[model samples]
Target: MVEALLEARNVVKQYGTVRALQGTDFSAYAGTVTALIGDNGAGKSTLVKCLSGVAMPDGGEIFLDGQRILLDSPTSAQRLGIETVYQDLALAYDLDAAANLYLGRELRRPGLLGMLGVLDKAAMRNGGAGALANLGVRLPAADAPVGSLSGGQRQSIAVARAVAWASRVIFMDEPTAALGVVQRERVLEVIRRVRDSGVAVVLISHNMPEVLAVADRIEVLRLGRRVARFAAGDVDVEDLVGAMTGALEASALGANDVEANDVEAGAQTGGEGNTNGGNGR
Candidate 1:
């Protein structure tokens, strides 16, 4: 309703003989968690790659703030305020939490030393500390090596890093996949905080309850296409499972159940499809 902060129009991707995506149109808005849910092999990973600049779609367009743009590389996407936290967390094990946060974008010392590429360890450490605090995430210490942190703590650092730098959108790919129940809840809270801070959060997950609990809107991807969209409040877990499996009929929930105008947009792009249970990831 606020106008899509990010949208993919008729996006397509392929892998040799496999058509990973069939003109999938996806959209996300500011200050909301838009869940991308599907069985494995639903092209969720492919779509994530495309949206995050890890891979280009074989065809289609991606728009940000109503302006069409190209995400040719990860840096390009980052420059455009798009950041992704993959399931892997991608942290530097040997480096401290603060160091991981400032991995490639470390702050520099003042004046000539700064010009000489001298690392500003103190500044980074303090900034990391503040950022974590701002996100309500408690860790052992910013100076603690990431490898020494718990799974939830590491995931928190990853989310905190993204939240600190993400100006527009953040893509979270199965962020709660490997966590314990408590850790999962912790990350979910961090995600809610990110959404509350006005960042467009795209959450990809297989856990229906978690998706329903945290997402503002849910987009069901079946095979390589989007089959349905649901307002988080309008549909229950049964409805989502039905939609994902094509058992409830595509667009069965109808657009009236949602507040956004584009709720039915995916129906126009969906078609015959197949997705391996949960094996695609």
Candidate 2:
């Protein structure tokens, strides 16, 4: 069997009396979009944080390319070709799109001017434009400040930045949370382009229609662990909701069987997973 490009096994996370993740397992393959969906307190955000290196798991292992790896910090994850686009779409409102794309990884000029920390603005502008263009994102003005752009454009810039740097896996949390129909479709197009580039795209979303529209595979989380897995073509919104709420029997789903321990752990939590740790989904 081909190993997943990224995988998590028996992952656990705790927040002082509340367990956010209880031996959760996850996997993402290259050249595919894997949707991670769950209800509000299902530990989606916590798992993303652990995988993206924002926080360390209290227990369990994470693997990249089938090799066990440690993600101690966000920078460490970035070095390993892992990037995340959070819902807030962290961008400098005062800076132009080009500047925001190269916010931290700025290109520098060669020679003494480079030594003096001079940024290659023109190169970045051209490169940023190219990157956005490659993803089918068209801005009204390349030089326009991100603050002045529409919500969709800003979201696209955030995705573009992640795509420009990510070579292995990209985790997008709620990429299309709030947007008009056109903008949402545009961002979904960019996601398709990224997936086609052979990078594993792990999408965290609550929009069932959007998830079914874009995801090749779907993993359902309940409480803090995976309850079901399905090929997007095999399930509908009802199935997804059933998995998330534990309304349907895991064994009857004909998907991956839910582990017994995970179900028990979830029961022990009494649905307090989201509130105790400030680990809101």
Candidate 3:
């Protein structure tokens, strides 16, 4: 097996009395997608916070590329080539797609002023266009205002940025939640490209079909604790839902199942009446 690009062992976190995570063991391979599934408040967001360095874990360790390290802050995770695209997609609506693509990490020409210098707009445009093509995503234009683009295009920009910048792991939080049919497919296609390029992907999604379609493995987070792990081929969507909902036995499926349960369904996902199911995207 390939070495894990990111690994969390015995990880625990708390927000006063809430206790968001309880000693979770999670890992992702360099060229595969791992879906983190749960009903809600299953510590999915908290786990993402810890993994992305948004918050520090109260205990346990995180290892990247086999080296145990401390993620005291998001900057640390970024410095180590870990990046995340949140549900908002984090784009500047007023700006064009290319502009949002390089937000904060803008390309600049060699001039008297460093960051104060003018941006290399032509280069950025070309580079951003290339990145979209490289990921097999189709959009109207690279210069289109992000606000003017379709839901998929905006999501594509966020995903394209993560792919363009990351070297190891990319965490996507509900990437397809607010997109249309064609748009959602485009986003999923981009995800496959990310994995194909050999980057490990951690997807926090409520859409089980999306998870089953592309994930090589599924990890269930219930009430902030990882309750079960499933190989993509070994478990069906019903089983996954059962696992996520805390209605299945640890040994529901033989051999391939690793059982864990210190937490139950503390949260409900965006599917059903929840309505934010990015799975459609």
Candidate 2 local lDDT, 32-116, one digit each (tens): 9999999998999999999999998877778899888889888899999999998899899999999999988899999999899
The deviation in Å at residue 184 for candidate 1 is 2.7
Comparing candidate 1 with candidate 3, which one achieves the higher TM-score? Answer: 1
What is the lDDT ranking, best to worst? 2, 1, 3
Q: lDDT of model 2 at residue 118?
A: 98
Q: What lDDT does the true structure give each of the candidates?
A: 0.83, 0.85, 0.79
- Which stretches of model 2 miss by more than 4 angstroms? 255-281
In candidate 3, residue 86 scores what lDDT?
81
Collision pairs in model 1: 41-280
Question: What does the lDDT read for residue 64 in candidate 3?
Answer: 92
Put down candidate 3 lDDT per residue, 7-123, tens digits, no spaces: 887677768977777666678888899999999888888888888888888777788988987777877888888999988887899899788878877889767554587888888
TM per prediction: 0.89, 0.89, 0.85
Off by over 4 Å in 1: 255-281
Global CA lDDT of candidate 2, please?
A: 0.85
**Taking the tens digit of each residue's C-alpha lDDT, what string does model 1 give over 1-281?**
57899998777887999989987878899999999998888899899898999887877778899998888888899999999987899899889988988877999999999999999999998999998887677786667788998877888888888888898999998888777898788788988888898999999998999999999999888878877778898888989888777787644556424644445445454532223111121
